[model samples]
Target: MKKEYMAFLCIVAFLCIAALLLTGCARTPEADIVTRKNTEALTDKAAGGTENRKSLAENRKQTPEHYSWKYNNDAETLQISADADILLPECEAVPMYRLSSGGFTQEQVTGLYDYLFQGRETYRVEEGGLTKSECEKQIVRLRKQLEELEQQEQGDGQGDDDWFPDDEREYLQGILDERLAMYGDLPEVSQDKKIAVDSTLMEQTGIDEREDGRTYEETTHSLECQTDEGDSLYVESGSVDTSEFSLLSYQRPGRYTYSSGIAVPVDPGNADEKKSENLPCTYQDARALADGAVQAAGITAEITQVELLEGLAENGEDGVSSERSGMYSAFQFQYTRTFEGISVATTASEYVNEEEFSLMWPYEKLRIVVSEVGIQEMEWEAPVSVVETVEKDVPVLSFADAAAVFEELTPLSYEGKIEKLSQGETDASMDIHVDAVRLELMRVKNDGSKREGLYVPAWVFYGTESSTVYTSDSGSAEETWSETEPTPWIVLAVNAVDGTVIDQVEGY
Candidate 1:
């Protein structure tokens, strides 16, 4: 049960992230991706107190009435609903392009440094050494935790520290002891504070043979710096295979958990009565801040998702005690690459050899976390540089044909997994319902030795899956149990040009 509960929680978080990626929309001039809004029909229906006359028309525009797939046998059932539009491009054909990563120039590195450290006291940090200020902050945080633990042990049963397990007391003490020792031996800050460019950071790490017989290039270039305000910044450009991506993180030592952890928005429906109790900045404000940060980093992409970082409340369950206060902390935005005004389809799953794929080709994404105070963190990973166009106006399949391909391959993607998961149940069934189908660019690797790939048109499917089970005990009627999870996954990616299914993880 414990393992199942933990798995369920992970599944929920995965679905939440996937849903945000597919449905999130923050249009920029560079990425004019379609955003359909049927507000007029909704308003008309509300005014008339019934379904509006144009409801049918709007539904037609959103999804086709037919093309659903269903299958049933003794063990389970698979039902796929093609309830979303096959949003194809306006042009007759979509072009494919070759992509690769390259090294960063000295000018580029200098410019990035200037932009990141402008108007701030920044000092280049040597590798493997802790700063005096950050060290002191850690010591303070550890001491405070020890103090809280001690007080909790001596307090009445109603104290908030019940969530702090008694067994971890010794562990915290060990960490505090180490920090105290380190603090006494740390060096003070010097007057020479100007950052010097580490030329090695700009060089490309050529192919390296690993112990597992796999070869890779260390494409990431990184630098660590300390600010006068006790904040530390660690920036990395490029990734394991290339140097075009960027990552900037601001770490405030000993930050309160409630101030810097994963969070979701408060219920907007209750915002009126709970205005003062939730996030201070509105969505618009957060969006503007996020745009500015993206522009500062010189990134050209589309905002795929924006989420409010409203802290979690301490309800007796879920390990959070009521003593832990909740408040609005930050805003997180996810961005994806765009090609010729079309956003590339993105996914978390990698369907190939993990080590090889990561070292050669990985999905690119940009994420920014902003707070009322300022931008907390920014990351752009697995960036690609377009080398050339493989084909201009490449003819592609029609939506009808693509739908045919979607129906054919989706089952194969989930074939054995469903049966394996429901093996022990007496009476078990499953439903695979697809809610959205998108026409987007998919990166497929060029069959060669070098790190190169082509971005081709593919039809990506997204939706949910659910399962039910009925079990009986001795002399008792059967009890029903069920689990439903969003499958906003790239269930299958059908090549628009050839109707062949593209492996999302392998990039081919």
Candidate 2:
């Protein structure tokens, strides 16, 4: 009887276990449905009219549906929403800030050092160490001489500081003599020329899969443009691009054209895509190379200044050349312009500042790539025809008064740009500041509607804006402040004679 009773209890226990298993939650699909519905409702309640919706509204306010850049104020995050149809899964974020460059920096230093010390192919060394770039060397020598003079009491014949006692003598004895051969008398001031381009058929560079092993690489680009009055222009250059073409300043109906280019590999062998070995060329070498190329293309506009502008280099990695820099340290020699033989500005001697020149001359220029293969790729643009007209000379306002006038004219808000270099400190802020102001006396041309453009005297102001450094781990970013040119923030022209503003492509 005891054994039977125990067996009966065991059977009851097994039946209960079977019943629970049959009615378990795993067998009920409705439970999952219920949980999913509850989760969906909870998620909607949390996000709707809350974090996500509110943020989207704010982002739309800052950036419209038409624009790409969006900012989330609360999170302090910014994003650039690309085209809805396009996809760039490999693309990385780009930093919001890059240091602004303006005053004498790396370009000037490197160019000057190389030009003075290193010799070039066609740049012959004279008996007295004089080369084609003698003017530059002379300026260096003059600066040293000036320093020696500053240490002494008088500009007497007893010491080596007897060259110039005054500005006129200094100009005649040192500067004039050294510059006579290169630029006879007063150097030609650049005349204004304008070209209008409506970029059609722009094929943006997508993610490219270039060969990783590149001892040398070459690229090509086709120039396409049409004038504002309806004229078609097309040309091609050797390299893909050094800089994406942008209309820096435009005066309508100007003549602009370019020449075809050639490129050679630095090394035909090595089968290596290692590093962007510095192109074995000094500043003097660069100058000579640029000169030969420009001359070969029949470009006569003189090179007033040479700058080593940092440009995009091909990485032996997976990225487009248009947007990112790679292992190779790429550079371009940008030659700023002045109308070589015909540049004229009738102004007081004190106001003639040559160092701060380009802000005024919105004219001709040249850009060529410097590589181990030699200087083959070049971009040249200048005036086809300029009809000069004489205008009655009028007296102009002082520099102080001119600055005041410019301030009154421009409606600038120091919003996001860095403050101008400290009037006192070394660090610069992210906000825009106007620290330095300079004036250039220019002979602006009237090249728009009429046949004769005015040979009018104009006062051009150049202001330097401060820069903020970006060290984020974004697209091709570094840990330190980048060595960039000082920012030339303002370019405004005030009529020297009548106090009227010349309305060209205004502002920096």
How do the predictions measure up, each by TM-score?
0.61, 0.32
lDDT of 2: 0.32
Q: Give the TM-score of candidate 2.
A: 0.32
Candidate 2 local Cα displacement, residue 454, angstroms: 3.9
lDDT of 2 at 269: 27
Off by over 4 Å in 2: 1-277, 294-319, 322-331, 340-365, 381-384, 389-396, 407-455, 466-489, 506-508
Each model's lDDT = 0.55, 0.32
In candidate 1, what are the lDDT values of residues 193-295, reduced to their tens digit?
A: 4564432344336676754577666655666776766655665666324423354455532222233234443443432333233345666666676676555
Question: Alpha-carbon error at 206 in model 1, in Å?
Answer: 8.9
Residue 31 of model 2 has an lDDT of 15
The alpha-carbon root-mean-square deviation between model 2 and the true structure, to one decimal in Å, is 30.7
**What total of clashing residue pairs does each candidate reach?**
1, 19
